[model samples]
Target: MGGIDNQKKFVLDWMDNHAKELSDWHQVIWHFAEPAFREYKSSAWYVEKLRAEGFEVEAGSGGMPTAFMAMWRNGAGPTVATYVEYDAVPGNCQAATTRQEPRKGLSKYAPGHTDPHSALGMSALGGALAVKAAMERFGIAGTLKIFGEPAEKVRASKPIHAAKGYYDDLDAAVSFHPAYMLPMVNTTIWDTHCGVGYNYIYTFTCDAPQDWIASDKYSPIPQNHLAARAPGANDALIHFYTLNESLRRSMLPFTGLWSFNEAILTAGQATADNLTPQISQIDYMLRTDSIEQAEIISNVMDNNAEAAAKATFCKWKKTWVAKSRPGLANHAMAQATYDNLILVGAPRWDETAISVAQEIQRNLGLAPMEKPFLPATERLTSPQECERLMRKQMPEWQRYLTSDDYPDYTWHCPTVRLIVARPMLSAPQGYTYPDWVANALGGIPATIDPMIQSAGKTIGATLLDLFTRVDVLEAAKVEFEERTGGGVGGSKWMAPLLPKDFKVPHQYRWPEYVTTARGEEWTIPYRDDE
Candidate 1:
């Protein structure tokens, strides 16, 4: 840690040296803005760069066409795996200002870096290059792995990378993201990858008289066609407002639907219209810090989707999607890491001290008070009695209302909230956009630039330094043994064993489905009861 100045200088210098290249990479990626497995251009771009860098590059290794793995080795030593995400939020083309309006509606879909995942790829590239340079300059013996992961907005698909045995041989993994401030560590834990569960998207096509509807005689046939386009349509905001009201009344008990709802609404207002309204297809994953809560929330989700679909007369489709291993849980283990960061040198650590430091951070325009890694049961309880109990039992929640990252106060997080205003231009008479796509469009940059770079750099460097100090490489050995009940041999790595405790992950096939050539028999593969 004594070399804090030097290390900071090195990282900054590295970023500066690579700025042109990184920005080029960023711009290229920003321009393409591919989504998930469909990231052909983005993937090819990275693969070309990685190949030129003399790393062993493998394309289509993870049962995914868009995903790839690249590795470089200096000597026989511990393996460290890093990840890069290149998928763009679908259908969000815009001018590069911090604004929420599309310059003009796109004819063909033009993926935008609204999510700034391009920044993700750049960070991974930058960090990996820096570490490789460090290892070489210092003559350190270790293996450096950089994995190209896809589709984070929904599935998070990292578990798929795990299943591909991507992390199977790694000593440890590191990821840096763009955000508003340096969080010592992110507390929104619980990375639960789920199987593609099905819900009945019962489309009650209004079979009214021709004059009854404003549009043409729309049939269920064309419905599926425009469904995926829902994320890019003008009705997206209405969808957000409507869903918010719907969930406000009928949201299930102890479910993080509220969080999901808030995230969606924020996305809609800040991003695009297609994002919220024409949610013809719902692809959602449930995550929380507690496994018990995760399970309860999952059950609630299944029940709620089923109930909603049945009520709507939608047919059920069961699509087997794989959920990632639970998100990085922030229980005792993670908390210990936070506490350890304090034991080292953070500006402040304790609640009171941290609170004051948080104010300073806010003054600096950094997002304050990282979202708490709370359990679903506690956070999702919408009962009036629970609200009353909170006032009496956890007045701290009340105290922090002025500025707290409580689970219930998710929307209050300025970073998470998206402010909506009428677009400068009038909507074209026939103009439409995807709801979810648009929601993501407007707000994604806030997560990356100046925000994520500042936050991620500070936190990532601190974490890496701590790991180096505490001998995290060795600790991971013990952690693997204790958590997996396995020995600390080379097998003591990151992949989850199947049947016993893990299983092959489900694949995501979105916006595409199989059907008869005549279009008579429909096969909506992404449906709830497929």
Candidate 2:
């Protein structure tokens, strides 16, 4: 094989040549701004593009209509995979401007890229394509897979794919996200990685209204009179919401951090006439450091759901949306990626980019600095140091603080989680800017392109190194086997937390755009005025 340095240069040069196309791709996805499970157009665009580039594309993998897998193989060797997410948040819709403005002809609350998975996904695409170019040119032997993961806002898809054996046989995996909260320009999460999380949608249906009323034989009312039925699904929903809150308070106190959050899906059908509401759904997600804690929380939630159903005279069922495992750290992989990051360097803010950020700050009525981003964005922090800083704010025993489904990929194979900087407006030293400012910056090309390009180059270089340098791949695999007992089938390894037959919750009433007489509209209809 040729020297690793030559392969790295080939990949970097490929990225440089395709930079404009990558930027355009990022723009299209940012404008698409489709939300979870509803990324139909976005998915189709990716499938077409990947196929055109000679990838063996599988659309609608894992029973998710919008999820896909793209693969390119040359000869035979280690299989390295990287995944992308295209889902946007529900209520963060903002246009690409310095001020807070919704997209033309869309609801102010329509979906937008908050973490801006647009850049996240496009960068991964650029990296994969660049690596593909390198492999073909240099005769590097390996298989590269790019998985299209949808519904990541709800931490969905990855767990399902893993359970269904899509992630099996992977030598290593790379995951990337737009950095927020953590200020580091480029770093992989060290310890205190994301914890186990469970998401479920509990549905209550009042199908048989007659069962709620007393028997006619024992009733004193006239024969022609209509008997009053129970309060129906609305009452069931209220009962569940209240009881869930109470149960949350009753959970055992521990030094580790945990959280239980709920979002109501179905309250009641719109109606003028007096009739019992039929269906109500409440979605609950819990994150904890261990499976034991998640199970405890899950059991209590189930009990509360049953009691609520019994009391309100409704039938209840649950749909498991996501069950994710805590991340397993690979210091070997972290060091390897960090080395590539140092070589690639953090994103350099050109004059135009700096001007755009300063303008954003000026619009926010805050004094703009010469440097619009936090100082941390221009520097690098070791993974160990990042973890130390993160833990300082948490209890000593809190091994898992936040939650993401990427951790599930770690259990199956060595996965490196890379975070790259996305620009944030510079405010006065001790001041804060509004979220819309950051959201607005995410959509602006002048501000976000650097992140996209830098991440693409770094990831592309890392992929090339992994494929061409056998020692680097072996180092990552050795760490993986050590942590996972004996690799995938090891004694200490945990099987997928989900059952093989676990039904995908695609039928749930997730937010999506709709078509009406007025043309396409968000689920929460947009108003031209006010």
Candidate 3:
């Protein structure tokens, strides 16, 4: 609990030797910058890389074309796990430069890594591979598995993996993410863990627009205002979104951080005239502190869709994007990870990293200070303090406060959600920075490598302790069992939110890059001819 062991040292040193390689891969993913459910190049590179490392790779593990699971075992021992998420957010295409601009040769609407999942993926890959090397050199006995999770921004993949029993055999899971906002940076979660989220799509079709009149006895003139064509899909979508917004307060108590947001996947399907705008799609993603709260919000949404469809003479169907469980706390696991984090210490920014931050400030028309990054970004927050700060606004009875699908792993086995600081700048007094600032910082190698390097070292150290220390492993298992009321199949245990036979909604129209006559572009422009 105090100092690093010889075995742990091996993995940390492993980070030192392979740091550049990991950073190089980070840039590779940044350049790929593929959107949710469309990480073709990103996922393929990871698959090939894992195979080259002698992993028994499953290219499409959970029936997702871009998801993968790679495993390597060394004799008989405890099996621990970790994962990589490489999906980017669409419309976040700012380049990794001081000025606001899209990456070269791409449109401003192209997908980009906002969370900079680019570094998140590399951090875990570096950690696991380091453990793999240490396993051989130190004759450590255990199994190591790394999952390639795609479409994380959509909250996809992991729930499917959980239902398919992919996580059923694991003894532990270590989750690493870049520090997005407060208290979570450089700490493990003690309590007040991540909340639950539900994502769904409502599709409306105006198939019977012509039958707006009773028995279709009335004649209808095409493309004429006098003809009273049915209100159509576009009108129905408007009804649902507007109705949902009106009832937003009644859907929940409005006492905690609970809300739903929407995205219009397709509005009029590019229909030029009043061919009744045949179909439309809208996506809703809601997060709450409890499954009960999620259910409360979901019911209102379903009813709203029904009413909206009926009013506009359209029929609709609901498609689930993802249904994720709230994270369960494992004090033993949290403590172990925090101990390792303290050993690694906080991320240290050098002159180069600082200079990049200063450039960003200057571009924003603010005077750059000697230290541009937030102090919290570099300071360590203990697990207890994180919980206290997280619970400050919530009621005493509420147990969770945020949202993520990673919690799905906690139900199956012990999981530790780890975070290392990505470079977050300290703004001038009363001047808030724009999102593009953070996005740009994430992509620049000089600024982000410090956080990436820290994660690799911290993750490797935690995994090594799990493999070699029986006491640490058993303690985690004990806490996990207690939380789940005897673990996996117990009375308090919650099964995967998505059914085992649930189909992934990859058919939805998500923004993606395409190869054109010119070359690969963000999305092809509208065309009349093939």
Candidate 4:
């Protein structure tokens, strides 16, 4: 039933003819490596190329200056939406495939294609063009909407658009990501815009004694530095720390503390100095996937502000404040689109694929996978711990803020999946920005060998075929319950796969564990005993 319909045959043929051009376009996009919401040249190039394909393109939409939407069709059949993303992760800017040193040309951050959003644009374009050719050949009438979303690295733009009702009318949507497998269907759910941050500010003012004393007997005499307000100094320091502690306690486990020390660097027309001995202002963010959770987080942040203000300035405790973006709730509709794509011939790698990835890491002298499944508990603590969870070289904590609270139970859900049709010639170094670009370009460790990569793709494609089968989703909905000893339905798959009691390679750890040795990206072999 998943076989190419006469319409699909035409689409596939069109894809085969343009595969080389599409690959070249994707590679160039990878090399350009721009950051989110600021993709100038890359976005322009895509627009130009897309225009050549006969799409009526809108350059900016959704309140984002860089966003775009392109469409082609007779406006007759089911409206299907597809998306293309070309932004790179921030920091570690580079264009080399082999392990390269961090670009030292700048004092601060450099952009990198870690996530490889370049491939997303190419893949979507490829698919859309194929669809266009099919429509023209078979004279089939249908609508295809391709949206170029921006700032996925900074905020949950997609969901914001969805909340604005951008995707309400579509009959179905599809997307394909480059992974180790040619195609595989996943019964598991996927989530987008999973985190957020909130900022808070506070200020304090101290009053001085009013009576003037020049000299003796009510004279307006100035006192020595040590004699004036000495007690106030002691009071201020103790009060500040106490307030800080209260703030810490109030913070949600998933939320992170934005270092007040650093935030001051951005103070408008002002700088931290000796005169401002009294603590003046503060900022913070609360991150979670649930609106209810966010509300709870807000309560905690606000309560902390109030408590701290009261303890310090007494009646002046009124100097408390709060501001924040709501955490990005997972999109069931997008997850359904991802699942359906896999079911309809998208590639994916399974647990074994993760093992192979671990092996690849070891060959590069990288750390081995510690456990097969992601830990059920988030174990989130401090900014440092959350950074470790993301594993990217330049982690944007301000971008994805969530509580350390891991899901209470393991759902069969798959966070993200990829099919690698090609073997990576090298491994990316630790926390490298733009790692997703590498991941998108069949990013796998070189140590795993080309044969494994090829084999993985074979498995992935097979899985995709299964997903593409017309009735597989329905069939799996029933079968998964009996086999896994779990409840049935799409929502049931939301549970995470837990680390406990799960068997997996010791080396397949998250991105944070790997490091660069000498000049090459490598990790120590997994040592369970350690």
Candidate with top TM-score is 3
In candidate 4, position 2 carries an lDDT of 58
The top-ranked prediction according to lDDT is: 3
Give one digit per residue, the lDDT tens place, for model 2 in 109-182.
Answer: 88899988988999899999999998999899999999999988677899888999999988899989888776
Q: Residue by residue across 299-411, what tens digits does model 1's lDDT show?
A: 55555555544433232233323443322211222333333223222111224333433443344344554521111211121122323443453323222111111121111
Clash tally, candidates in order: 55, 0, 1, 60
Q: CA lDDT, every prediction?
A: 0.42, 0.84, 0.87, 0.41
Query: lDDT tens string, model 4, 1-530?
Result: 35545554555555557656665666677665666556666878877877887888888654555677777766555555666777765444543333433333321134655545666566666666666665676565666677776544433334434434454454334433333211121222232222333233333333332221233444344343322322222233345446656655655344542322211211111343222234343333344544455556556545555554454442123211221232222233233333333334423345554565455455446665544222221111222232344444324534433321111111221112222233232334453323423443232222112222222222223222222333433443344344335542344333221212222111212111122453422122212122
Comparison by TM-score, 1 against 4, better one? 1
Better of 2 and 3 by lDDT: 3
lDDT of 4: 0.41
Candidate 2: Cα lDDT at 513? 83
Q: Which pairs of residues have clashing backbones in candidate 2?
A: none
Candidate 1 lDDT at 55 equals 89
Superposed model 3: Cα runs more than 4 Å off: 1-3, 214-226, 252-255, 524-530
- Native-to-model Cα distance after best TM-score fit, residue 251 in candidate 4, in Å: 6.2
Q: What is the alpha-carbon lDDT for the whole of candidate 1?
A: 0.42
What TM-score would candidate 3 get against the native?
Answer: 0.96
Q: What is the lDDT of residue 472 in candidate 1?
A: 46
Residue 107, model 2, lDDT:
74
